[model samples]
Target: MLDNYEDILTVNDLADMLKIGKNTAYQLINTGQIKSVKLGRIHRIPRQNVIDYIIEKSR
Candidate 1:
């Protein structure tokens, strides 16, 4: 779906897609296991960064 190809994803969406908890997702972001961009007061995770992280960690 086109919607699934978004440039950025919310924390909730990340958890749903990765089958993880919000806390775990936050941990990943905070620990730099995943990349994120903070805009205003919101944190947005870029899709490409998540993909890259997955690939890097899978090795």
Candidate 2:
């Protein structure tokens, strides 16, 4: 279930969860589709944000 994921997720984690490529994960963040926070040069995505993206796409 989505709730099983960590609160803060890395790009790789996002990719695994969504079954998407790493570039596609970056694209989602770059396109403002999935909200993320910057930690140095890394993007940390929230589980809720991913859930939101899922709901948005499902619509």
Candidate 3:
């Protein structure tokens, strides 16, 4: 469903998804463990990219 798709997820969204803290989410973003894109002054994590990164790392 289109509603099930989220192109960009915020830090809170990522934290909730990963069941971690906001600080941890920010740490992942900062440490490059999680992939993200910056729009203007905002940082957004692409859901697909995060999934892909996890999958790649798992392998």
Candidate 4:
């Protein structure tokens, strides 16, 4: 489960939260299903975007 106060999440964190593989999480980001910002070599996903993705997919 994600912390309600978390503002940002990494690919690894996304994988764990979604119960999927790390590569799958990267694919979602690469495919634009989940929005992310690239900071140097690291990708950061906003917590709200993750929640939105879940809501969108559930619909």
Candidate 5:
């Protein structure tokens, strides 16, 4: 589904992909709804995590 995105995705990228705001993307990460790795001040989300989130939400 997210073939255009790389294996690792940035919060902004995720936001754009989901058509949501950056705050909402951050909320998803902070709430642990979408798994991510925090590196210093930056967050890296795996492409699979987003796919999983979509699939989970569909269920």
Candidate 6:
């Protein structure tokens, strides 16, 4: 479903991709499990961070 692995992802995007709830995705970001950058009120999650998180969890 991922068209571009290099593109940055929003919280909603991450949630949809992982098939998780929005709150859970936010929790992961808040807990620092998924790295993110804050832009004012918006959080931008790097594509690589999501990939890394998946890899870490798989191991």
Q: Could you tell which candidate, 2 or 5, scores higher by lDDT?
A: 5
Error of 6 at 37 (Å): 0.3
Stretches of model 2 off by over 4 angstroms after superposition: none
TM-score of each candidate structure, all chains considered together:
0.85, 0.93, 0.75, 0.91, 0.96, 0.90
Give the clashing pairs for model 6.
none
lDDT of the candidates, in the order given: 0.84, 0.93, 0.81, 0.92, 0.97, 0.91
Candidate 3 per-residue lDDT, tens place, 1-59, comes to 22354888888888877779999999999899898987887789988877876688889
Clashing pairs in 2: none
Predict model 4's lDDT versus the native: 0.92
Q: On a 0 to 1 TM-score scale, where does candidate 6 land against the true structure?
A: 0.90
Best by lDDT: 5
Task: List candidate 3 segments past 4 Å from native.
Answer: 1-5
Candidate 4 accuracy as TM-score: 0.91
CA deviation > 4 Å runs, candidate 6: 4-6
lDDT of 4 by residue, 1-59 (tens): 56743689989889988999999999999999999999999999999999999999999
In the range 11-39, model 5's lDDT, one tens digit per residue, is: 99999989999999999999999999999
Question: Which segments of candidate 1 are over 4 A away from where they belong?
Answer: 1-5
Lowest-lDDT window of 10 residues in candidate 1?
Answer: 1-10
Position 39, candidate 1: lDDT: 83
Give candidate 1's error at residue 48 in angstroms.
0.2
Candidate order, lDDT descending: 5, 2, 4, 6, 1, 3
How would you encode candidate 2's per-residue C-alpha lDDT over 1-59 as one tens digit per residue?
77778999999999999999999999999999999999999999989999999999999
Candidate 2 similarity to native, TM-score: 0.93
